[model samples]
Target: MKLEPFLLEILVCPQCRAPLNEADYDGHPELVCTAADCGLAYPVRDGIPVLLVDEARRPV
Candidate 1:
């Protein structure tokens, strides 16, 4: 599911507080951190962003 534009604009990485960009990962929607140093990918489950740092996927 796609997130609302306003919600996407206000959402930031919980770890680094960087702006997040929407992306498709493994056929699922996700919010990916834009910071080079902290590129965490947070899952978007059922149109709700799971911003927990522990639940974020570390950049490879």
Candidate 2:
């Protein structure tokens, strides 16, 4: 599914509050995160955040 503009507006890297782009797809890599500034990512599951700093990874 395509991301909504408002969702994008409110979304931040969570790790660095940089910016977030679509990172993964449904049942794919799972987490949808991006942080070009900090070079970090945050994972989302079932539309919920994993929120664990260790769980975050660099977007592939």
Candidate 3:
């Protein structure tokens, strides 16, 4: 699924309030926190972004 550029531009990491960058995770689209200290990855399911910190995946 494709996230709108406008939405992506406004989305931030719930963990650190850092801007989120678009990336691919397991062949699916995801949003990754730009803060190196946080390194959280939020998944997008059915065009909806799951931005909860508890739901975010830690960087590998």
Each candidate: RMSD: 0.8, 3.2, 0.9
lDDT of each: 0.91, 0.59, 0.89
lDDT tens digits, residues 1-60, model 2? 345778767877656666566565444433344544565556566666565668876544
Per-residue alpha-carbon lDDT of model 3 for 3-57, expressed as tens digits? 8899978999887899998889889878999998999999888878999998889
Write the residue-wise lDDT of candidate 1 on 1-60 in tens digits: 777889889999988899999999889888999999999999989878899999999888
Q: Which stretches of candidate 3 lie over 4 Å from their true place?
A: none
Error of 1 at 30 (Å): 0.6
> By descending TM-score, how would the candidates be arranged?
1, 3, 2
Q: Using TM-score as the measure, which candidate wins?
A: 1
TM-score-better candidate, 1 vs 3: 1
The segments of candidate 2 whose C-alpha lies over 4 angstroms from its true place after superposition are 1-3, 25-37
Q: Each model's TM-score, in the order given?
A: 0.92, 0.55, 0.90
- Residue 42 error for model 3, in Å? 0.4
